[model samples]
Target: MARTDTAFRVIAVPPARAFAALVDPAALTAWLPPEGMSGRFDHFDARPGGAYRMVLTYADASAAPGKATPGSDVVEARFVDIVPGVRVEQAVDFVSEDPAFAGTMLMVWEVTGVEGGTRVDIRAHDVPAGISAEDHAEGLASSLANLAAYLER
Candidate 1:
């Protein structure tokens, strides 16, 4: 079956602030990578139909193999939808030769105001078979934690 993973966290910030963190390329550069990885974007345009490409490099080369090159995974993505202070979505495709990883995926981020903070939910749709679900989930969780840390700072 095709796999889609979802993760959520509440941050101590308003929805507008949370939305900014999600959509701003600079903020993304600060917190998008999961633990043990770092990312750099080739270009980022946040408007609808805009596009971006990024390369994520593992801190340890051994950690990247079949899923990526010796040390990095490259992704080309487009901004699918963006609703200020509410939601953002992107269509993502990995730049890989392996058929198992040759597919376009969708990622959505929803931000809503809560009593004391903002509720942030992220959904990754149609994950490639080459990526382990457990590791992906951990990465998502780690990203959320990183975002929280960045926001709090």
Candidate 2:
């Protein structure tokens, strides 16, 4: 249903470093969650049409511990396009027979090499209209921050 998504842009210290951080598990885990949260890829195949899955854990909201999700959310995607250290596009889905995401979702990541690092732009289209834009935006912003932090280190 048309394109309804959030956009966030951030500069990475080094463009190549930013690209490298995305594919590395250690790097990925280091910066992929919001403050007070953590996550990592379980088994990621970054190639086109590859299966990508990641597990995210939220910290307890209070003094008590939190209940973790049983499994990682799985998405079925086909690499629609890829340019090494430059950009990537993937057709991802929720993997449910449900009509919500039974269709193709286009996730485009464009990275431009700048003087000091890189400017990255991400757009996820075909998102169900049912989801909240605020949540989506916040998640992506946190992820970008995480990515930046990982690269800086």
Candidate 3:
């Protein structure tokens, strides 16, 4: 069965700044990876219909084997929509041979300006069965925290 996971964080930056971090390759490489993982993009183009390939490597793969390889998760994602200061949506797929991880996931990132800063909400739809809910939640939260730090600094 397909499932959805959502996470939100109040970042201490304006919506534009938060949205910029979402699309900039350098900013993404700096903050998109969750705890214990590091990410790099093979190619990046941030626009509607543009696509990018990202590889995420685990610092300690023994704890959690990757979906694409023993130590890494590779993702190919296309931009579905990009609304400045509001939202960025993407169609993402895991580059894995395993059947459990075969599917295109919709990742929507919405940023709304709040009193103190921005409220960033992430909604992931049709998450692959191979990814556990608890782990995904933690990963999302970790990435959000990283984003906050990246922007606030």
**Which one is best on TM-score?**
3
User: Candidate order by lDDT, highest to lowest?
Assistant: 3, 1, 2
State the local distance difference test value for candidate 2: 0.65
Better of 2 and 3 by lDDT: 3
- Please give the RMSD of candidate 1 to the true structure: 1.1
Query: What value does the lDDT take at residue 11 in candidate 1?
Result: 94
Let me know the TM-score candidate 3 reaches against the reference structure. 0.98
Off by over 4 Å in 2: 60-76, 95-103
The TM-score-based order of candidates, best leading, equals 3, 1, 2
Instruction: Please give, for residues 1-153, the per-residue lDDT of candidate 2 as tens digits.
Output: 476565655674767777766555577668766666766655777675566665555565453232233332345456676778987787766544445445566877777887667887778888755345786788678788777766766
| Model 3: worst 10 consecutive residues (lDDT sum) | 11-20
Candidate 2 TM-score, C-alpha based: 0.74
Clashing pairs in 3: none
Better of 1 and 2 by TM-score: 1
Give the Å error, residue 17, model 1: 0.7
What TM-score, computed on C-alpha atoms, does each candidate reach? 0.96, 0.74, 0.98
